[model samples]
Target: MGSEKPSLLKGTVDAVKACPREIFNFWLFFCTAVWSFSGVAKGFDEGNIASIVVMKSFKTRFVLDHETDDQYANTKGWIVAMATAGAVFGCLACVNLVQRLGRKNTLLVFTLVYIAGIFGQTFSSGSLSGLYASRFIAGLGIGTTTVIPSIYLTEIAPRSIRGLITLQYACCQQLGVVFGFFFNYGITKHNAGTQLQWQLPTALQLIPAVIWGVGLLFTPESPRYLLSKNKRTEALKVLCDLRNLPEDHPYIQEEFAGIEWQLNAEIEAVSGASVWDLTKETFTVTENRRRFVLMFLCHMFGQWSGANAITQYSPTIFGYLGIAGEESRFLATGLYGIVKFVSVLIFSIFIIDFIGRRRSLITGICLQIVTLTYVGAYLGVTNKMSTADIEASSSATAASKASIVAIFLHAVAWSIGWFSIPYLVSAEVFPIRIRSLNVSILMAFHWAFYFGCSRAMPSLLAATHRFGAFAFFASICTCSLIYVFFALPETAGRSLESMDRLFERPWYTVRQVAYPTAADLADGGLGDVERKITDEDLNKVTEVRIESQTSKNH
Candidate 1:
């Protein structure tokens, strides 16, 4: 599998086409749905910060009025980015935590940390330092929450629906964002001047964390993690339950065989390897290093594509587009949130898997390029007008309305491609041996950029026109589209181990390895690949595996 194009289609066709019972089960969906709630925790935090900062009570309590423009920008930047900074540390720390505690426990533990951060944030009152520290502490939870769920989902989900399952985390994140927006809107309408207006949203972040923590208790630990711990019997049982099939079912056996094959290979690689040896290998090995570089670029590109800036600065951007007043801008921002949530939901359900990762990314990036460029060009013309003339001109207002529409379209486009795919690619692209280390490294970079980009928005917008920022984002999206179209492989339907082999190809040719022909699988990959599984076949496979182990051990 490390060097061969294994029959990815084999499992889907033989397992599902020949199986007695269905592969997709209620429990499998239920467990994944529960795990996906962790995304909500991260999203809730992301969605609320900008809105909360704009609230009158939040501003007054924090005493934000006295600062000069630059000072105000710096303070606001720190306030918004601190949670992400904490998340960076959390992401880095998760590699060891996930390995030691297993995915479910790691999530539960982090959820508690997240909940505690919420408490401190809600009650910190006027203390900015306390709020920043608390958000950082909460970010530690967020960093782990964001990465672990994708890893866990990748390990547990069926290959056919793995993309869909992983994307559900993204969907849940959008749901939480929607909650953040509407919660702020509802509070503004009902609780306007009270501390509760801000505190309610901050405290409300706890609901998702609490639900995820409680749900983790009932969910199964990742079967792959169990197997890694040498809990083979338990792992097999969990796999059976997850698949809703007999332990001896062909689908079960084939899936087990693929995973076992890779685990054995990893054990062999790490048998006498020291910490330095593994670390060196992670960098020195061509495949491992390639995966790392690819992951780093993907996350970096996603952040720089300008979606976070839009979400975090939506109200302000709306104002720049000439949407008048605090209430109107906030209302427009809430609608922006709804647009994002609905777009992601639609993309996840109908588009992601069907289009596959590369196509989805390309399509989305193209749309973003168009929308961003139009917005930038529109503002370039209109910014030259006098305030009275611009306000009085119907044509200026028409262009402004069009820019808002473009922003919403950009959200739709961003959701389709960059928003969800990077995490899924991170989850499925690496083998278990380096999966945690790799995902943690990449996610930390992501959060770091998230912090940098979101934090820099105030300065970026101030130093340049909003149009210039949009133009820069559009340029980045253009570069991103080129990178994705040529470099990123389609990872939608393949088994995880297959990804190792897929990347084993020369870096330039990696994109060509997504799907193998029937003849290719039979001749060089999984032999006799398309036949139904039988008892005799399983026994023969087991015999070969045993003999290989015996000879290697000797």
Candidate 2:
């Protein structure tokens, strides 16, 4: 087990098999799923926006006709991308909320902003001003939606199944996609020419926000967060409840010890540092800077991959590929959403931990490269895809059918590769001391690029004739491929505390090899099999670190 990059899932898989019933239980799953529910509204908004924009009621209300095609694209881009622009602000605001209010409370308070934003938008009949303001307001609430949930899950999760739990946040986002696409299609189909067609879909976001708020009332504060506040007894009780283990049990003691070690490591870094000092440590420290760069490229390249273009403008993209009717476009978009949801669910549950993080990303990226290239070449050879209603062919041509398949394939590749990988990787890889600041900064970039992609998608397609845009996305995917292969270390089965060791090796070769490649040792301290530390050693650290901090204060 102490050999080369040991089979990625062996640590988790063995743990699951050995204690399937005892370790993984209903309580743990329940708490994780409730927070994951927050993603539904985000997904619905993202998927629903593009579909709703093409609705007859929406077009009528917005008076979408413009003097030029470029004018029309710009207007639509602003409408869809505005929420993300607000999201950038939300990310900036989240650190203060999470720091002062705690993770659960921050989410609870923001649900109202999200709900208020949705309420304002649903009722915005003919006012472009109102619609834009609503989108931005909702964006404020939505920004915290993803960042906090992933942080909470990773913090509370048992080491063995942490990846599975954290990825659930992404899984639920797809579930939202399913609801968003299908709901828009259902409403548009039933309502037809009525204003309810757009209003109902727009208002559907409130349901998830309400559910997440109520659930937050019952959810526990992150045990790690509690430890950070020096609530030792409270932190232990929370850990016991979360792990479903006795307070003094070896597993519980070691798990608590690992967190203390990380906390101590954090204290050692700044040692009574203030906010400004912490911010400086974020940049001045080599590891922190390296993680920051990884985050920048993680999102920037991801947005350029063109998958988001497909997600935000699938109806438009399909229409360009020669799909001919409003009904058909909506149907195709709805189905595309389903494919992404199913792919994420299957892979997160069955495959992600098994293949390891880097491999899953690599496999998905390869699929994206192949599919994007084919779609680009097909559009080039045909030179005929359009957003306008072209006459429906008597029968689907082979080339068009293949392009449709290629687009769906592209969605699948996106679902598996870039969809959740960036968030999951970002959530698990950083030290907890600066995790919130880093995550906020990372997601600010996430939404910033998201805003850029959504805002530019229409114009990019319009300017590039759809074909060149696809080619450009393929090129970006190629760069992400190289980055993942060279930069990201495998994170599967590692405890959060041990992530530092993964980056301890030189930057250039991080992806080439992992430290403590042995699966058992990968847990850093919690490894049940061949663990290097004893239960007493864990208890000793727990006691000594607290006393050391106390004595220093005196």
Candidate 3:
């Protein structure tokens, strides 16, 4: 194995070079990066609120009369969770809107809605009712923007680099988190208890929304959406533009043909199928059902992995560890955001495609399980210690430092596994016909669980303290590890059109599944290998195609 490592690395490098570099042209890069602003908006909302809640001014302005600590904690959780609650409705509403309005238009409309919500949030500091209403509206925008970008990026990206490109969403989200944290930290450190400290951060959310919305106007509509609507000429044109290739390029023709064929197959399958029938088939069809379960479970596991709890309540967690002082808490929170940002950035660039989806998720989850267990145990023991003893004992200080290290490590692990895979897998697994609807359904569950976890974190910490909450999350990670090991298939480097065959087999199958060639489908040879094809079959077809093309040139 050690001797073969260099050969394998060389082969991988050769394969990458064989692909066209034109795919990374300026226009494509611009569009892909701009689409990430939606994620930034989401990250900003999540991170900004967490920091704002810890602000003295925010609490002074918003906390109720004669509110106890528990009540205050609940109020903080609710305020932080309101955006997620709004996101649920937005996800559900976008199911049909995406199909009708198309990806670009849907994102544009919702971004405006998000900006509107931001204005409300900025100005409504005087009234809690207005604040809640504005957040829910913004949540609606977030839901729509979040789901559409994944779909759009998946459709636009070339299959070879799809995983890496799609990961832009996660990277941008972390970027937003970092910005939010530092923005809040700066305001808190300088502005102190002034309303502008919180208000300025709230207002800053508008920048990404406007940038994404305006950028959408310049970017073309999704070719997949165009094809789905039977705009063949427009789809072809957009494909050419996106690839920076001509209409007659063989690669372009092959890709277009593949998409058309897959769309036709789906149309044939769902010819007379009603909404109820489609939903029923989604669960009853073995392949569809399996994919749905995996995607849903992935989302659930990612959210329940304690990422949001740590992010949304980092200050509180620091406090629980006996790290007192507002400046210290904010500094810790800022460091947490920075670590997450850097970790996610590194994973997206290096590990995502290299390790494949299954291994990355399992490895990350296992690491999390160990970290959570250690943190939970340490916190539990410390909770039992008297304040005087804790202050004087060197062991307590050492344990506190260890807990901080554990939390940072947990962030790194979560970044590698749960942060982006759920979205990437969901975008790739579902058939194009039902992609929007299926993804929306799963996203709703994501937001719902996100809301639950965020809302419950404060109360959970109040009722169970540090140990109970961390242990509970650790148990969830354990279950996630088992499920991933037994169920989730590797999807890295697979074509979107080939996912149906990929999920049809049992989990134990180790051989690569071959997708049928264009000629095979045209000659009605698809009948022979409609179920599954092996790697050898694909190589044979490729060799024949190369030979025929060479012969024609001669």
Candidate 4:
């Protein structure tokens, strides 16, 4: 028999090919879908359901004007606002807690918040305070859900499919919102004033949470978290379960080693290494700082594109534009969800590598600017139309239709760019030592902006009206595109370490080369392959550098 050559690269490739695709993809999709269940409620839950149905029911059934007539006008915004606020607080508070609690525990806690929020929104009575409080609690859960899932998925996913899996979360979010808007539209259409109608919709939100919590209880916690706990054997077992591998699987060893090496490397970057060791590494290391900056900018740009405003208040924006039929608008929003979901799926399967991150971001942001600009112009012109102009013609009606088109396009553009890529990039760029902490900080900014944008957008649109708000988001998109065009690197086919190296150096090669070209790597390399390193050599470096740095810093 011919001797078999020891081939590290070939073995790695074989392991990936041998891994179970369905199991990995299922968790990614399921986690995404569970959190996205609330997306359906974003538009209607914000007093719209109360306005359209609940308040009127209270008036007719109980002869309560305060409950039925003016209740939503006075209180719905705050109710809607509370969830966003709760999410902000939840994410920030959980930043340190996420590190301690680990990914799976945090996710489970958030799922419980969903269950609590739904039951409260469904059965609670009298004051709106209970409903709002529940949503606020849910929002805390929602923020954590949003942040941690992306972190977990990014960590567990193979680099090749990580971007696609991350994008699934964004799709689920949009799909949930789309579904909620349309689902309520259907439920309230003929019945209109049924309290039972609102109850059913709010109650449905808990289904995914129940499923996710139940399903994940049986599933493994993140192998990365297992490793951090120094439970190597358990981590290996979790990896095997997650990847459908045997205990002696070669790739299992490689990935475990990769994470360990990365962690050990970060320990070397710190001094007086205590519990805050991760933070020390991030601040002191040149590469870690650069990765943080890149991830930070991604969040800043992603939020700046106005994704929250659109998803949170699409129906309100449609109403402002004078879209006549709530039913048709809701249908269109559902269609928008379908488009986003399909587009994300397509991108995940085919376009992610071909188009690359930098180009996709630029394209999505630029398209967003254009769509928002068009919407603004239409609204601006309609806002200027006089009472006579309004009565004499159907100009506002035409503008509303145009506005829907623009909004749909904006959602599509976001699916292509700002919605999913930032999370994927944030999770991918960081080393294993501080991946959770780093992602938490970036997601904190993300959800904070989400809270700010959604809460402020309604008031902004109500006050400045459509023209100003749309234009403002458009301007933000322009700036984001410019930033991507200049600063971001093309990490399409790069390895994790190579991605780290791209940011660590003073210059970005991908930015310099307008397209993927021969000059982009050392000796025209693709820069996607993993390098093999021995545990002995890795430990030697870890011992020497860490002790040196700690002694010097202390």
lDDT of each: 0.79, 0.78, 0.79, 0.63
Per-residue accuracy of model 1 over 111-214 as CA lDDT, tens digit each: 88888999999999799999999999998998887778988998898766565677788888878877887788777788888898899988988887777788
Q: Single out the weakest 10-residue window by summed lDDT for candidate 4.
A: 524-533
Ranking by TM-score: 2, 3, 1, 4
Error (Å) of candidate 4 at residue 360 is 1.2
Badly placed stretches (over 4 Å) of model 1 are: 1-26, 240-259, 285-291, 384-389, 424-436, 485-554
Question: Per-residue CA lDDT of candidate 2, range 381-439, in tens?
Answer: 66763333223442335667788899898888886778778877775666656765677
Q: Over all chains combined, what TM-score does candidate 3 have?
A: 0.84
**Cα deviation of 521 in candidate 1 (Å)?**
7.9
Error of 2 at 259 (Å): 4.4
Cα lDDT tens digits, model 4, 1-554, are 12222233343455557655644556545554544333333333432332333234533433345553234333444655677778777778767776798877777777787678768767767456676678788777776665677667766766544545555565566566655666666766765667755666667676656766787675567778788787889888866665666766676677777777665654443434554777778878988887787777778778767766666566556655665455655555556657766776676556555566777888888889889999888878888765456546776666667777888788778878987688656645665457766777777777676666766665566566568888989988887777677668765444444555566566444366434333332222222222212344457657875786799999
> Residue 307 of model 1: what lDDT?
95
Candidate 3 global lDDT: 0.79
State the displacement of the C-alpha of residue 548, model 3, in Å, after optimal TM-score superposition. Answer: 28
Give each prediction's root-mean-square deviation over alpha carbons.
5.6, 4.5, 6.7, 7.0
Cα error, residue 324 of model 3, in Å, equals 2.7
Query: Residue 420 of model 3: what lDDT?
Result: 81
Write the residue-wise lDDT of candidate 3 on 52-166 in tens digits: 8777787777756457778877887888899999999998888888889999998888898899999999999568888889999999998886788987988888765565677
